[model samples]
Target: MSAADFLPRSSLSSLIDLLQQQGYRVVGPQVIDGAILYRPLQQADQLPAGIEQIQQPGQYRLIRTQGPRLFSWANGPQALKPLTFAPRETLWRSHLQADGSLRFEEVIETTEPTAVLGVRGCDLAALSLQDQHFSGDPYYQQRRDSLLLIAVDCSHPADTCFCASTGDGPDARAGYDLALVELDDGYRIRAGSPKGQSLMDNLPLDAATPEQQQQTDEQHQKACQQQRHLPAFEPSRLIHQGQHPIWDSLAEACLSCGNCTSVCPSCFCFSESEVPELDGTTSGHQRQWDSCFSEGHSYIHGHRFRPDTKSRYRQWLTHKFGSWVEQYGRSGCTGCGRCISWCPVGIDPLEALTELGREDVE
Candidate 1:
């Protein structure tokens, strides 16, 4: 617990200006479609002010706050994944050559540099996992390399959140350049990298007092205590539990709509498409986010491995909690609980795990 620096609430907007001066498109939360959405933030006023989200399993609502608070909600539907790993992207395009040959070129987007403000600890953990998954992906690198991360601590954890159990956050622990804890009147900022240090040096900030630092720590502890959590289960259990009847129960209630994967910050399954012109001389290839629950995902040359809803659900659960550890040396889930909140059936993955792990499940 090093002494932190304080940034007055009013001067917070100046930090946005500093990032903008460095040619970074500052993105933060905004009220959109009756909920908070992360988008390009131009001014501080554009932040979701005087509003907070009340979230539970399969339910989300907004409430007018008694006071001014920019980021009171735990999360929106979107996470850092969409910002780095595109939902749909043109990977490459091939054209018919003049000499009856073909040529191919990669399609990498050259967009403005981005500074993600208000990143959560769980999302940061998810990004690190994705970095390993997409290490060789040029498009992902293109979006990730020039970006700066400024994480805001969750002072108010949602009922659906479980970052404490996941050890990812009630506050940012790693992978962020700068981490901020919001107070009633200002923010207590800490540096996690050289870029954060450099940015810290130039900002119009004051040294934080011991009382302010204590307040930040208290709020962080309170958030961890408030958020819901999952029962502890070893990663290896998920591998053996694949054949359990719990998967069948999950399938019965499951819609297989792929909503869980889309909302999960760490899910990285994708499918590619190729289109040809009428002349069949030129072709276009693109990639999009895919879910294991999708029927086509299990298809290979007209044979589907997990055709049934039960098997498909099993695949997603196993990959996320079991085989993922073997493949990547880490569990894929960060415990942000977006899956539970966004799932149409309100089917919580933890409940499935608990059911499958029971002594009688086998």
Candidate 2:
């Protein structure tokens, strides 16, 4: 840890200017279409100031507040996943040549160096998982290397959040260039990387006072006292529950709409296909984000392994909480609770897992 600096709320614009001057595209949370979305930000005013996100099972609402804080809310539906692992991208294109020889060209997207602000701790952990999964992938590496992560300690966690239990969040710990703790009139900022330190050097910042550091600690503690939690269960135990009846019960409520996976910061499933031109002159091979809940996800060799909603739901839960540990040394979930809040039918995975854990004990 390094000595922290204080930047008054008014000096936020100066930080943005510095990023732009360094030839980086600045993106941050903005109020758009009734939600806070990450978009290109040219100025500090574009941040969702005086706004708080109220989230619960199956519901998310934005409430206008009198507070001047910019990053008070816990999180939004999207995370750092979309920035590095693109939802839809062309891998390569094959063109028919005049001499009948095929020409295959890899499609590597050219991206501008970007700095994203207002990142939460859970998302930062999720991004680490993504980096591990996409290791050696050129497309993912290109975007990953070009990103500058600016994280904010979550002050007001939604009721659905359980990052405290997962040991991933509420306070920005690691994986960010810069971390911010929002105060009433300013922010307590610290650099986690050399790039962030360089930026801090350029900013006209004051040494963080003891009182401001105390305030930041209190906010982190408040966020940790959230309502939801993943149950105490061995991750490997879920692998044996394939035949459990809970799948059928969950299937009754699970729309299999894949909303949970979409909003989940760590869900990395994607499908690839080839698209041919009508004239057969050229074809493109592209990949897009996919979910285990989808029927086609289990389709292979003219047969679908997970034909019913029960099987599909079982696969998702088992893999996310069980087998993921074997592959990644941790559960797939970062405990951000996006899945619980975004599910249209309010299927809480934490509660479901608790039930399963109880069943195992019984």
Report the number of the highest-lDDT candidate: 2
lDDT of each: 0.86, 0.90
Tell me the spans in candidate 2 whose CA falls farther than 4 Å from its real position: 1-4
TM-score of 2: 0.97
* Candidate 2 residue-wise lDDT, 268-336, digit = tens: 999999999898899999999999999899999999999988888888888988999999999888889
Worst 10 residues of 1 by lDDT: 353-362
Candidate 2: Cα lDDT at 192: 93
- Which residue pairs in model 1 clash with each other? none
**Against the hidden true structure, what lDDT does model 1 obtain?**
0.86
Q: Where does model 1 exceed 4 Å of error?
A: 1-4, 277-280, 360-362
lDDT of 1 by residue, 276-325 (tens): 77887878898999999898998988899988889988889888988899
